[model samples]
Target: MPEDAPERVEGHTTRRVLVTGAASGLGAALTAAFRARGDEVLATDVVSTPLDHRDGPVEHREHDVLRLDVTSDDDWAAALATVEERWGGLDILVNNAGVAGGGRIDVAGLDEWEWITGINLFGVVRGCRTFVPMLKRQRSGQIVNVASLAGLVHPAGMASYNAVKAGVVALTETLGHELAPYDVGASVVCPSYFRTNLMDSLRGADEALGGVVTALVETSPFTADEIAAAVLAGLDAGEEVILPDPAARAAWELKQTDRAAYVDQMRRQAARLDQLA
Candidate 1:
């Protein structure tokens, strides 16, 4: 242990955690967050790049990086086997693997739609489906699926992204209800926007409108580490909808109070996209 590192909580049990998309973004940030709190983390990304964990809890682990594809059954099985063999049990799974894709829904082709849905939506679906049994058998575990505010607020140009994340939100909500009886926790994250690499994977997006989205993201008052901390706090408190920022929280309230009003407001905001040209 580092001399200056914060001490682990007294009597705190170390949790065995698996995080997808662990190479970067929320995954990498949250992996460090879990490790900082003395939790054992299995960080997986489809890309096999070695993680730069030179000085963290996972720095001295037997393996710091595990290659697992969120969209592949073989990969999920292999990852579970590795976890089973190493830890003999699992405690936390953060299904954070996803891609960003958007444009006008009318012009967004089937190929891009499939590509985004495959990675963003189906990827989360596979993670939940594959890990639910383990969690059920243990009768206690946490599943955190990362959705987006786009799911709750349907803006223009993000039709597919909205659909996928909304599906995640709904699926995880239902899963939470099902897991309540077993004492397992389920949560869906609906963060508005933070600084992350999600923008790097955008597909079929209009350049002018993309600039608007990028501006909003970059100018947002939140950071990825902040989001990660929010995730940890939310999970620790057993919160179902983990809205990481004030913007997301307020929007959530609006949607809950009046769906038609929220939709009208979103339609008004999305009208700007048409003027972007």
Candidate 2:
């Protein structure tokens, strides 16, 4: 970005932000980043872990997406009511909650796939279902759904996660178009790697599958702060899609040019990864 670009982009400031999955990692980083910029941030996550950061204007809370299940209309209604009571009107919402499902689509149990998609995909859907109305009432707001580079270009061994994130990307894209009438912007963030407890947070249908995913995460290399910065940039620029890393953008470009070729290339890469393993 140009020296003045950030300043120009951030010319306007947001009053309030609600970030899901804020117990740690990118969610935690985002809470601090937004608060540092003078926004009142309400960060929530399923875990009841203590939020130890003290660098900004942040209010932390425990939020279980399962409790706020998007699949449940009543739950969505209640959660929205609670959010309305706390902030009056929410200016921005970052749907950053997700889980990793193993790549073995064919062999992965149906229950495991369902569990992951419910959290990773339907989680975002529920957020939109619950919050979009309020945002519309406010007439100006932003919804940032945290997808993955997998959403843009799937690699082998992440079938469920890839599918859900791809759904998030598609949903947010359509949402952006739908929200334009209300002057509300929707953005889908596709990030690669990102150092986070994502490995530890895996909620598989069983223990053995969880172990497989945990091993893979040990090799991923993306920083939470970097991804947070990318998210902030997307919000500031009013971008419809945010690719948090250069490699993610490159991968996306490759997929766009030749999707079949991209899949074959990823298969080769996976073979190399297996060799390393």
Candidate 3:
């Protein structure tokens, strides 16, 4: 361990975990990963889809994240009511529900931006806000918010997605600070491209908004299982932000070294990608 690095909490065997967006992608993987480790896992998603493929037991809930709209108090109340009834108290809360946004700032519609921010950014805020009390009651609990590599380094071609994820990163950091008094921990997951149904989900949303964003998903590399594994390891280590991939970690380093230089580099990379297309 580094001399200045914070000590990590040991991973416990009997933790009760709730993962949102558990119908598919990283959330599903996380649910399975937790279950495999003998943790009681309750998986929730808007869609009711069977998640266990390996006889790895996991409870399921058809949760509508948008119904709570994170920004609405009424919705948060209803969602927390459901949560309380299910687990009684939560040991870990993973806010993983999100959507992809297509179009540039000059062309992207405001409604699309609103929808993206509501789910990607405000969703984390709502989850943390509502769960802090539950976690405090437990005395020790962790909250993990799923951001993206774009959150660390806002890239072009997907302005709204970048902006919303960046907001998640910021919100998670601030919440981590505020919740310290309660012994409630917070972490943000920032990952690069992961091979999962994430692209299919984005493609569906893109159909309603426009079809530009699907192309980006089609070309990305990485796997949800790998990302999930890294996240579990990070949680075991009590990291504030769990970065699973090299591109994402490098982006964080670049941001720390030189913000302007990082922006310039991303601009040049975006131009190169444009040329490739």
Candidate 4:
């Protein structure tokens, strides 16, 4: 253990957790859930302000909220320093910061691709790179990377989003095996469309496709809080790949059980998008 590491209790129930992009949506919900469960949560986001409770309430009574831009190495280093100083060590790291983006292959520019990749895929990459060594040294801790259902079920007009989210899934799966020897568990959350402010960060050239995605997000029955609850439960169950919602589970099941049908469905969706265009 490091000199500053906190003494590990034999049966410590409370965890020291750091969550990224905790200002809104699922990130905020996860922070609230962890805190509610008696865990010490360090909620960090790019914004240096308080949680926007307009979406929903998250306890903010002097709890540590740091400004962490996931794309910035300096910010990640500063966050790691804060964790070591304040908590001595971390029990969990949630790489949940990401922006929504999608477009047809030809329509979405390379700049947009780079932008989303920086914050979505590479953001998670940086978090894991920065923290995995510490977790390995400690031989403890869990990493939960928040990916989208699109990561598993790729659809039309979402090439950029699908690719990056799939990258997150692959990364998390690989970490699951690679970190197991060190006793550090990894899980990737793939949730279907849920009621979230994810659309607020959406950047894409295809307005119609963006509108369709926004509608799916807004009209979904599930909420971020609900998904957060499922995630906590999934973590407790030690699940490697957490499909947090019914839709996600169903889609994945379909793909696994009926490959031809799944491909046909994807093709049909693509044709529909084409019609809309």
Candidate 5:
């Protein structure tokens, strides 16, 4: 363990978790998981309303979502205030609000780059900046940043998306060290494609590449709830980097153990993407 690793608490202690992008997908799954474990969750999203999924309305529960645009500092501040007023201080901060975009480096426009970065990367930054001080003051908290497999094992035709997710990975790692002395822990969740409405936020100059990603997401055997369960288990085990799926674990292991084979596979994928484009 690292020198700054926080000591694990014993026994069941209810935590107050604030999850962004909790309107649906992995975020909603996380919210539900924590609540099921007898923790309090303040779910926030770009929309403040009753939670609804693609399948149907969320089952009637005492669910109230706050409106929080992660890109906005004012919104983040408001969230902090609300947390203080309601929960005294937050125990876990889940920076999971992100949009997806991918294309060839030359094909993706700067506008597309900015839009995705604002939500995917900087959104997490803003959340940390706003809440880290409070966490440090209290000397206890955890941060979970939701990244993607692209962050760890980058393929082709996703330059912007890869860069931002990789940034999240770097940020989370750095925080793990920086906040360790304060009795705080940080984890980065890098799950591969699963059945999620993440495609709803997909935007790219290359429509074909978008379609390819959509298919991968739609066809994945894993579900958001499954991924959420894995995340909680990883946290329980004091893991800093959580690879929630077997594919993610395998790809990361391949990259770590055999550089030559990983490079060859990435090259092959790039060539295939070129053919599709």
Candidate 6:
């Protein structure tokens, strides 16, 4: 995208959307989704890796991909400052930056817990803390935080991932209450097995367990783009909790209707994983 591209589309009310973790996977897909709708997006991540922008809707827009480490307070301040100065104000904030440390609590040390939580939970806290004031001043905005179905239904060997994502779920649910009076809507997306590289970055995780996760996800019917589609639609409709995959929706319902059964089922799944290991 050109730096001097038009701020607004000729006849459309272009929205100013800032998406974190936009270097790949769901974040990149969501950025493209918004860009396809002609919105100005600030796509950010921790690195400047070359992106897959071919045939993307961002071909003729002002959506620049930037390097932003979400765990850094200074990075949050600088990123928002750039948005405030260049785009004038923020309309949509997607805190999609997160990490998954794929191991049980016993295998994952306190260090792993702290690492994933820094980006998964506290990063979201900082994003909302930094931008809510701006949104309140503007009197309208939306926030989308990416959690996981693991938050709804815990599985084995994912204690840290489950822990941080559950916190994100709680945080975003509370954010909805706090932002309503200011007319700022909040959403927490609980995505199930999608074809993202989430398992690839796992720290101190079993290689066999990672393979199992990848196989399950790759065999699923959903993709990153499909999840992004659900997220964009839910955001447009002001839906609170966005469950993008059928497995996620099922798990959410099971948690609501039969907590004991859900736990038993997960226990069996854990037993199977034990056998595999």
RMSD of each: 2.9, 5.9, 7.3, 4.4, 6.0, 3.1
Range of the 10 consecutive residues with the lowest summed lDDT in candidate 2: 1-10
Question: To one decimal, what is the Cα RMSD in angstroms of model 6 from the true structure?
Answer: 3.1
Please rank every candidate by lDDT, starting with the best.
4, 5, 1, 6, 2, 3
Rank candidates, TM-score, best first: 4, 5, 1, 6, 2, 3
TM-score of 3: 0.80
Worst ten in a row by lDDT for model 1: 52-61
TM-score (C-alpha) between model 5 and the true structure: 0.93
Report, for all candidates in order, the number of backbone clashes. 0, 4, 1, 0, 0, 0
User: What C-alpha lDDT values do all the predictions have?
Assistant: 0.83, 0.74, 0.72, 0.90, 0.89, 0.82
Give the clashing residue pairs of candidate 1, or none: none
Q: TM-scores across all candidates?
A: 0.91, 0.82, 0.80, 0.93, 0.93, 0.90
Q: For residues 1-277, write the lDDT of model 2, one tens digit per residue.
A: 3332212225556477878777677787887777667676766666555342322334442332223334556765776777778768988888987766664555578887888888888888888988898899889999999998888787666678889999999999999999899999999999876567777656554445455556545566657777887788887787788998887888889889988889899889667545544
Clashes, model 5: 0
lDDT of 2: 0.74
Clashing pairs in 3: 195-222
| Candidate 3 lDDT by residue in tens digits, 25-119 | 78878877776676766666665444542324444433322243445667667767876886688788899878766555565678878877777
- Stretches off by above 4 angstroms in model 1 are 1-7, 50-62, 258-261
Better of 1 and 3 by TM-score: 1
- How well is each residue in 200-250 modelled by candidate 6, as lDDT tens digits? 566765655666787887788888888999998888687898998788898
Candidate 6: residue pairs that collide: none
